[model samples]
Target: MELENIRRRKQELLVEIQRLREELSEAMSEVEGLEANEGSKTLQRNRKMAMGRKKFNMDPKKGIQFLVENELLQNTPEEIARFLYKGEGLNKTAIGD
Candidate 1:
């Protein structure tokens, strides 16, 4: 009878251990998924300067002409901002008024 009880207890312990192992596996899977999501979010959040775009193929005279045409030297802070964000439809007179 004692040997039978020991065997029953051993079976119960094995079942508990198996349940714990399954729980551990599920927890590890969840952690891996969360880590993967974090990695993607980090990549999206960071803005890295694009590679191979730092150099421009232009003459110095052309660069100065372009700046002059844009009135870069005489532009106000707001005007420069407007030019920078031209797609946003900002009014030149809207600022400092």
Candidate 2:
């Protein structure tokens, strides 16, 4: 009985480790995507700055629009916002406003 319990616990731990590895892989891929797009983002940001726009002053709505317009993100505004903000995305009224 003791050995069987240990084996079951070991199996559970292995499953958890596999899950963590998958999560880590996903995070790494996201980082790689961000790095790959960094150059374009920088150039666009610089252009906006040259036109007197402050870099960090963009609200969520405008930021979503800019990302879509610039083709920086292929997803819908809500999806992108949720991805970027981790589910703190704007409401429908907020987007309209």
For residues 1-97, could you state the per-residue lDDT of candidate 1 as single tens digits? Answer: 9999999999999999999999999999999999999998766433221110111012323433344453442336664454335523322343222
Question: RMSD of model 1, in Å?
Answer: 12.4
Number of backbone-clashing residue pairs for each candidate, in the order shown = 0, 0
Q: For model 2, how does the per-residue alpha-carbon lDDT over 1-97 read when each residue is reduced to its tens digit?
A: 9999999999999999999999999999999999979978898776743332221134545655565565555557575655355423334434443
How well does model 2 score by local distance difference test?
Answer: 0.61
Best by TM-score: 1
Decoy 2 TM-score against native: 0.44
Off by over 4 Å in 1: 47-97
All models, RMSD in angstroms: 12.4, 13.7
